[model samples]
Each structure stands twice: as C-alpha cells, then as structure tokens.
Target: MDWSKTKTIFILAFLILDIYLAMEFFELQDKSDYAIIQEATIEERLAAEGIEYPDDLPDDINNSFYITAKSKDFTIEEVAKLKDQTIELPNVNFEEDQSFRTLNMILDKPFPLPDVNTESKITQFLNDNIISGELYHYWYTDEEMNSIICIQSYNSRTIFQSKDDHIGMVVLHLNEDNEIISYEQSMLEQIKEVEEKEAAITALKAIEALYNKNYLSSNSQVVKIEYGYYTHSPLSNQQILAPTWHLTVEKEDEESEDFYVNALEGDVLQLTE
Candidate 1:
C-alpha cells in the first residue's frame, strides 16, 4: 500500500464516524427538549382553563401489577364461625361448587360505633364485632344510603369504592340511631398479582385524560389524587382489578364527585355511582 494514500484514507474514515455521532447526539437532544416543552405546555393550558391539580403531583413514574381475584366463595362450615349475626348468602352453591360469594348479615344487637373520633373507634368495632372484619378498612359514610362503608384491603392499598355494589365493599346499614344494624359484604379472594410490575402513567397524565374526555369542567379543583385498585365490574362473580388513579374533583358550587382514571390504559373510567 502507498503510505501517503493509506494515511489519508484512515483520516477520512474517522472524520465520517465523528459526523455520524454528532448527528445522533443532536437528534436525542432535540427529543429531550421537545418532551420538556410538551410538559410545560400542559401545565400552562391547565392553568388557562382554571383547573387546579396538586402541586406535589408525583414526579416519579410508579410501577404496579395487574391483579385477578375471585368473588368470596365459602362453605357453610367456614361461614358458621360468624356469630351474633343472621347470615344470608346471595349466590350460594355457585355452579354446584358448594361455595357462596356474597355475605349479608343482620346483627342480633346494635354494635356500638360512635360518630366521634371514628377513625379509631370504628376500627375497634370492626375487629370486635364483624367476622373477618380485620381485613376491612373504613372508607366513608354514605349519608344518602344511611350506611357506613368499608372496603377490603391488601398490601396496604384499599380498593376504592367507585360504585354502590362494589365487589370488595361492605355496605353497613345504619338504624335510626346511626348504630351498626346490618351489612352486606362481598370479598375478592385469591388475589394474584400478574408477573413483573410495569411503569404506570403519571398522575398528571391521568388528570389530563379526564380533561381530554371533558370530564373536568372549568374552575374545577382536583382536591385529591391517590393510587389504588379499582374494578369496573360491579356485579361480576370474578373480576380483574387494575391500578387506578382516584381523583376527587370539585367544581364551584357543586358537590365533589369521585372520578377514576385507569393508570395503565390512561383512560377515564366511565364508572357510575
């Protein structure tokens, strides 16, 4: 090989490689800048519409698993352990499996659940009075139905109530004295988390989903946003629970309502009360 020609060829090859790397770096930088711009625009747009979300919206993208569960199926022997309450099974002997799903109970005497400092007081009543109630957590009082609502929990997350007959909720009917009279409980047993957890859509993305769907009106205040499991099947015997973003929105002069956004799908769940 001619020494002068070989040196020139080597220099040309390195020059071409340097040019290619420079182009790749610029392209990546442009994408990063575009993403930041898009994020800022969304914040400004929400402000223009007078919609408010939490300033401390989680910056980290969370990971979660999709779960599957069965309706509470029990045998007469298992349910016989419940005492001081009249028990009724709605879906008994499901498919000749000799198992029941729903549990309706009327207390023999009113269980004392006071209205004051109920955070601790109600917890006490549940562990002492209700059977297997240790698994249930106080959700909220439904004044419209005159009931104290509780939801089943797992892994430190309680299934949020999106509908009246939620499969994981216990609807406790209150008598005239606001005491525990009776309740209907449905549980999701054998909950199995699907394989590896995947990154979930951000809370900001969830809120934007609602706004895109026209669920958020102007002057709407997003009071709270929480991550949990919520199901769309209110009456299904078996259900799939997905990670969800539960948002509490309040419009001016309007009562606050709960809205859910599927964290995985990034769509507003058109769930009903």
Candidate 2:
C-alpha cells in the first residue's frame, strides 16, 4: 500500500484545519469589536472624544432619546466617516426637566382669570386673520410665574404672549409631525377690538416675575424664524421634519439683557413671524 502518500495527505488536511480555525478566531474578534462600538450610547462615544451634549437636552435623556434626538440614517461609508469623530447626543436631561415642569404647570389648573380673556382675544385674532387651524391650550413655567399659557394653533403654530409689553410674545410653528419648525417674537399690535396690549403686559409680567424669583434666563433663544412651505423640504439634513427655527441664547449671565436674549446670535431659528 502507499502508506507514505496517505501520511502526506493527512498532514495537509491537519494544516488546512488549523488555518481555518485561526481564521475563524480572528473573524470573531473583529465582530466583537464592532459590537462594542455599536452598542455604545451616543453620549459615551462623544465623551470619549471630549465632547459634551448640548444643554437643551432633558435629563431623562440618560435613559431615552428626545423626540427629536433619533439617530440620523447614514450609509455605511457615511457612518464610517464618524469612526474617529465624536458624535454628541442631544442633551436630554435639561429637556426632560423643562418638559416636566411645563406640562405640570399647564395641566395643574385652568387658565388664569386674565388669561381667559386673552384666550378669547387670541381666538378672535385667529378667526379674523383667516388662520385655519385648531386652537389648544399649552402651559409652561416661565421665569416669573409657575404657569404661562400659550395658544397652540394645532397643526400650525403656538403663540405665547406676555401680559406686559416687556417680554413680547413668541409664536412657534409646528410641522405636520407636531415638531417645532420655527418661532418668532412679535410685539403686541394695537388692535382696536382685541386690546391685546394689556394682556401681553400681564403675560410678560408673570414671566418676568418667574424669572426674577427663579433666576431663570433664556437658555436658548430663537434668533431667526423661518417657515418651510409644503413645497419646500421640512426636514433638515439631519432628517428632522418638524418645523424648524434657529435660536441663539447666552449660555451664561443672568443680569445681562444681552444674556440669553432670543434670536440674538442668529443661530437659534424658528418659524417666520
């Protein structure tokens, strides 16, 4: 029999098996590395590169993504571009706190006495202006008061005015997705029928009081407000389709009127006025 030839064949078979096992081990190691990267939170990944999340993020973000914080869809090559770049997740903690406080204030009680009349004014204004949309109540805590009322022009825009003339009013536009698209500050116009000036003053004073008491200043202010028409793209490059507004605010300083001023930096944007 050809014993030597058989022995040579056996040796080749053993060598091939060893090579295959080694290749398998290396492949598994590569997979493990990929898994570790994929499972990491965006914050963790960003922190590795010394980046911090934006302050607007709510605290609850530690456990969840904000409504607008979903990951952008990226191709494999596009994502690969981020391999060495740190990506910061939207800060969710601050946002959660803001949302909690805002929701609590509005849902806690009915509209204030003065606000009832203001609501009527708002309704009439909408009707007269031929603005088509549903109106709802939105409440939030401002610098001076525990609750501030805003008229949500459903599937449209929301308007929050100060009873006083100081702070003015903010108009926030929402997209079909109910996400903020843009916001703007408008001075109360002298309307013969509505007399919104007084109402705006009151709302403003309430907010100012809240601010003085709590040292609440603007965290982010909408600098430029722009609206996306149905004919235009609602979503930004990030694929966020909510109405968009640019905001600019002072991160530091409580006393400076310039501090935390809305729409000052030309960055924070919102819907058109």
Candidate 3:
C-alpha cells in the first residue's frame, strides 16, 4: 500500500462529500424560506409594502348585485347658463380634442384671476367666464393658487372616501399673476340618469384579480382602491364616463400601476397613460 496515493484518495472523497452536503443544505433552506413566504396572509403582504388594511371594506361582496349611481352630465340649460356669463377675452382660440371631448382654449392675453380666497376666485371664474354646476367640486390648488386649478365631478352616493378618486378631467392653467392662460374643459352635451348601475366589486377582490392575472407582483401592496368614473369612448367624439373601480398597487420600490375595472359591467377597461 502506497501511503501517498492513499492520502490523495481520502482527500478527494472528503471534498466530494462536503460539496454534496452544501448543495443539500441550500436546497432545504430555499424551500423553507418559500414555505414561510407562501404562508403569509394578505395583511402581512400589504404590510410588507407599507399599506394598511382598509377599514370600510364590505364583509362579503357580490359581483352580481347592482348599486345606483349618477353619471356626470350637463344639460342644454346648463350650457346656455355657462355661455350666458358673457366671458370676455380678446383673440381667444378654441380647439377641440376629439378623443376626450374637451375644448382646449388658448388665450392671446391672459386674464387676471382675483386676488381673493381660492373658493371665491373659483366661484367668480365659473360664474364670470366658465360654467357653474353642482357636479363640479374644487379638487386641488397649489400653494400660490395661481398655477393650476383642478375641478372634478362628485355625487353623494358614489364618491369614494379616497384621495385617488378625485382626479378630474377639468383643469385650468394660469400665469404668475393668477390669470387664465389656458384651460381644458370636458364638454358633456346632455344629462341622462343611469337607472341600472351595477354594484362594483370590492377593492380586495380587485387586488386579487390583478394578482391572479400576474398584473400585480406578490411583493407589491394595495395602496388605493376607489370608486371613480373612467372615460370611455365608443367612437370618435362619442365619449362616455363609466363607473369604475380604480386600483393603485405598488411594490416596495414604489413602482405602481393603475387599473380600472368597469363597476357596472365587471370588465377591465384598457387605459392609456
């Protein structure tokens, strides 16, 4: 028996054993970690993304049931009332966006907004130059209150108790002197009541749907889910505001995606940013 050859064989055998054991250890560890993660509850998952469970979630939501809600609309009388304000602007140009049914106005000379309170300014502007309606609510204004003014539609029954639900299609852009430089207004031609508004699915259910469809990451959290109106176009210049469930889901890195689910029909509406 050569002692040197015997020592080499022993060394090789020990190295192989060590490598096999290390591989087995890692495989076991991986499975254990995955099992722990898979056992996490929805709350736990949401917590990981720094989101809290919503307090007003319904106990059990039925997809088939319906809820009555009103859509945003303006009547001929309302339009005439707005036009009756006798808005005066020299060399003002108007262009219509066919897709959104919004009239984009560009002013040759900016009109100075009132230096009074924001509410008063808004009221005066609507009464003096633009339309005034109960449906439009003051949504947002900057600290200076001169750069931008956002107004959204709201109804008592359908407005969700979430900030995300307040995004409006009506916007007013102003100059440094709080003057109206330009504005985009949604032109709704008629008013009609929707009697057959269907009940929307719950926010949690919407999140689950996104997760199951792989649209949401398991590492993501449900940030916001609110009832709102999504603009849908059936054809050119024919725009309809459909009741929708808007969801905002985010990952730990804060990357988020917006999803709109048709509340009445329970269908996902395709959106373009």
RMSD in order of candidates: 6.3, 23.1, 12.2
Residues 15-80, candidate 2, lDDT per residue (tens digit)?
Answer: 999999999999999999988876545345334534222344311111111112121222233323
lDDT of model 2, residue 266:
15
Error of 2 at 95 (Å): 48
Top model number, TM-score: 1
Tens digit of lDDT per residue, candidate 1, span 1-273?
A: 799999999999999999999999999999999999987787788899999999998654467877887878656676667778877655556456565566678889987766688768778877876657788888878888888888888786777765456677777888888788888777778888985788889888898898888988899999988888887765467677888888989987777878888888887886566
TM-score of 1: 0.78
Q: Where is the poorest 10-residue window by lDDT in model 1? A: 89-98
Taking the tens digit of each residue's C-alpha lDDT, what string does model 3 give over 1-273? 999999999999999999999999999999999988775565566566455435675433333332233333433344344442233334544243112234455655676766667666765665466544344555556555444544544443232222223223346677767777766555333434455534566666665556556666545666666766565443233334666677776766888666777665667653444
TM-score of each: 0.78, 0.28, 0.51
TM-score of candidate 2 to 2 decimals: 0.28
Rank order by lDDT, top first? 1, 3, 2
Give the winner by TM-score: 2 or 3. 3
On lDDT, the candidate that comes out on top is 1
Residue 43 of model 2 has an lDDT of: 41
